[model samples]
Target: KSKNPPFMQWTDEKIAALAPNDSTERRGRTLASSAKWNTIATNYEAIWGECKGSGSQPYLVQIKLSGPKYKCSCPVRKPPCKHVLGLFFLFAKSSAVFKYQAPTEALKNWLDQQSTSTVSSASKTLAPVLKTEEAIEQAKLAKQKRWAQRVQLMTSGMDELELWLTDLIRQGIANTDIQKASFWNQVAAKMVDAKLPRISTYLKETHLLIQQNQNWSEVVVARLGALYLWAESFKKRNLLSAEMQEELYQSLGKIIKKADILAQHPSSKDLWFVLGKKEGVDIEGRSFRKIWLQGQKTKQQALILDYAFGSMGYEQQYIVGDLLDGALVYYSKAYPQRAIFESFESAKIYEKTTLNTYKDLNSMLTSYGKALVQNPWLFSFPVGLSNLKAFVNDKKELQIKDVKDRIIPLSNLKEAIIWKILAISGGHSVSLFGEWSGLHFEPLSMLTEDGILSFT
Candidate 1:
């Protein structure tokens, strides 16, 4: 067994941070046991290991600690795949298990290739190919043409949607067969075809509300009113301020590319705490993930949204409760929240003594109302509250009560989650973080004695 100290300082949480998703993290944990590896060795610069798999040949994995780069012979395309994470976990747990060995020729070749590729990529970036004046003008014209065409399609689609909404209101909400899928699906399909996926999502969610809620008549009316307002806003979008116009575009599902945001927006550097994460597949079968972060210094919140098509996974991985030392560039909006990382320097486990939270429910709601005033289309707003007790009200609904004894109902959450919260609080006050929709709160995570515990 090797007697040298571990080359890098890594903990189990740090290794978990490298996993792209919870599934990968669990797999890595399962493979962390020493018996899973056929061989494990380390040199001065790197760690290499081989693990047996279903295939005839064992999968080889290598980690270069300086760059923290990883290479695996497994078929997975994503870097730092489960095998690599497993090796990291092993080394982090017990480096003595790895035998000290000289660099093998194969390992040496891989290292040399990495160095050469790094230099080559840097040179290419430093000397990017510049387009000629004619090429630039042509590209500009092409982009303008595409935008004009898309605007025309969107206008027609919004017109159709407005007519549909008018007819629904004229025909009376009671007359419409809300349970029938085709009634909503037909219009939603048209919206998708019109390249207005965000409106399509709204329609689907309205349908779900009608199906799931007892007082859906009121909910449906409010939802449709918002949709109607959005359609009208689209018509007068040109007259709106630039920031409001950007908000409207985002609300309509127009994607602002990361490169564009990074190039245009100012970046804020801070020690950001990973608060919570939520992920699910939408009605369109596209998988989406949202990670929430709060800056320790600026106290600003940011939302990182990611989407993947069929069989594809998210590009980055983040573990809740970790601290990221980085800079983030936010998308343009009346009230900026969505952001993309401009630079990620380092990440580690957070060792904070206290959480930043609102004093009470009233204070949190006041802040939320202010945000809504800035961006009327805002749906869900993140909030954290301290000294709140969770319990079942007299109506048998799960709710949280603040220090002032004012209570707020929770959103429709799983029974398990509700019970877990109640159990954690034990009729006492606990700090909690979640999204507030002005109507109900949806708890995602809670700060406990140990650390932040995620519910989803």
Candidate 2:
């Protein structure tokens, strides 16, 4: 097979895209220019090499082109560390250096291990479905009993939380001092013990906001009210609609597993345009990557999340700006936004032309408010608007103005990048996409006639 295959060419631009940062890209370019690799070999699925690094022995480097996974016997910690990037750059610019041969023994062994690991994972996934009907019934009863115990614990935690909030309000939030982190940490620990981990997380994040934000008194109080409202709602959950109850339970940390989502939910097919990708590390040190996608035909948005533990890298199965013809099963929620892919008919590089956008600020906010009503615990909601202009306001803060001149402050944007976005627009209105976090809009990407420029 051709190393630089027809559909997937490992060109210089593609290699540049793969590099994690500009520093890494520059280093890879320098290494490739110096011809650092001593031996380079390629197979249909992989590229292997021995790079003469600044060490006694040459470093062994292997790239699983299919997995787009990189492994190098070097001290570098990041994925596709300098060596792998240089190898890819060489493969792209001068394929003549790589011998078209079968994989070496080491490479073969690694490939075999990867295959075995995948098979083992697939087998483990089937275990949940193997329970007999009687066993499933028993499990269900056991789960219900455990849930009852959790509810009792949670009630106690909520009672304590209510008293704490009442005390804080009575003392006045302006007079309160939250500098002691334990004020939040202790309550978060209690919630965790109560099996209300999601609530615990909300409290922890609120503590961060209290430290960082100037208007934190109002923000924290509002969030506390929302939390207390959710807790109270849970007390009368049976009176709520099925969708609302599902949303409540999910926000309370009742997770539906992958197998259940795949097996039970109905699938909806669309040509999904990936809008943006964000990667984050949680307090528990787990790595999470979320890809936001919007259907061209359906005009609906979906979020796909991938997670990894320590030292493990998430497999990036999709890329931004690509169109996937896929069927996705939606997770149960009042506002269904997250989904798991069920099947894909095909995928291709798609050129975006028109954006599904609101005509005015009122239109967008109305929709967002409706979604919040459906699920008050919603973190961020998507907003797309056309003929939107971005500029710095009097306070030097980035803001987006619609045709009607109604504007919202843009949060989380660097001042320099805001200028760049203005340059990209060239003083004219453009299509904009962002997330509304109750107070301000965090711009994700801007669409021009040429392409999408991601802010994340």
Candidate 3:
């Protein structure tokens, strides 16, 4: 039985074409051809590590890719083990049509060589390779031209924006909002999305001035960049950058003033932003504008922003550098739904040295103190928040004492690491949920009484 429904368009020829042996362009084809590679192309299953003789299972494992790519759980870590070698040999020796296709560029080059170099000596002088010096010059010019165009295009939208932003700072934001609050907010949001940290300074000062002095002008003009992007999004929702799409949609929920519902809604399902993702060449093809969603939060529902590639729209499976800044994510699902995003690399670092291993009440309290810095809701579990006898910080993490192997509360320790990161990142400021909502494990907010009690 096949895991794939009867292949609607799958043909034996197609399956043969995806043969793994030809996928590589190793120079020693004849030598490799000698190996009897025995392989079967079926629906790819998971990569399972198997050890035939133990010791430490052989270094190699078979990995199923689509259908053709396979790894042999042999003594090598590389792919297509001897099993693949044998499979290729068997296929070539047999009458079956299975054969591998070389990658596009390699195949093209090989074809060109076959046409020219393999021709009778008479044609060698007919089409000589382009002169290396000439090729280099052409390549350089092409690169220079491409960069010039990119710089020109990316900065083209900022002309009016720079002047407008400067004006907003001079006049102030809060005061300008009197005419249109949404406009000003939009600009502020865009600047943040653009990774223009300094510009945000201007927006903040303008906001403060508006609040304190009520002075505003060019508010709408200043915010034009972000608003225009959003308006365009409303007009062509799918065309907007990934970061912009998330920001604008989430913005609808957070807008102090709601847009009329009559406006067409973005009818796409939620795409989970799994941290650390890599897409083939989109990030490479476009050098500017990346989509970026913000750092993890206490509330799970925080809006996401797309980063233009090169500008941060670059996607990866995990946020690699500066763990605190942003996450690597992409849409993983659809429909009005709960999208799952991971913070594995950034958040998983704390999994070691847990307070559960601590023997003293003082140390347990200390661990809770650390947890409070990253999260304010860790009042129980490994601390004594759930038990009646420990730390007095209004009920926090629960801890058990080893005395007589009895359960107990952790004493309140002041040195919590969670509190440290929170203070550094800007302490979580909202409750994130209803008092009685009963849900625990909300990553972005203060943990609740029941949450602490549950962990205990």
Cα-based TM-score, every candidate:
0.85, 0.81, 0.22
The parts of candidate 3 lying over 4 Å away from their true place are: 1-131, 152-159, 176-456
Residue range 297-344, candidate 1, lDDT tens digits: 888899988887766556566767767778888896578898888655
Sequence-dependent TM-score of model 1: 0.85
RMSD of each: 4.1, 4.3, 22.0
Ranking by TM-score: 1, 2, 3
Q: How would you encode candidate 2's per-residue C-alpha lDDT over 1-456 as one tens digit per residue? A: 555442345557656756666787888877774367788887756778888977789999888765356789998765667788888888888766666888867789998776444311311354446778899999999999998897788778778777777777787776444557787888889888887888888888888767766777767777878877877887788899998888887888877887777777888888888786666776545688777888888888998877876665444455555566778878964678888776552244444545678888889889988887777778768777888877777987677788999886556567666887788887788887777777777777778775676665
* Model 1 spans > 4 angstroms off: 1-27, 41-47, 54-56, 63-70, 78-82, 89-129, 175-177, 348-355, 394-397
* Pairs in steric clash, model 2: none
Best by TM-score: 1
Deviation from native of the Cα of residue 177 in model 2, angstroms: 6.5
Please say which candidate is ahead in TM-score: 2 or 3.
Answer: 2
Report the number of the highest-lDDT candidate: 1
TM-score of 2: 0.81
On a 0 to 100 scale, what is the lDDT of residue 239 in model 1? Answer: 88
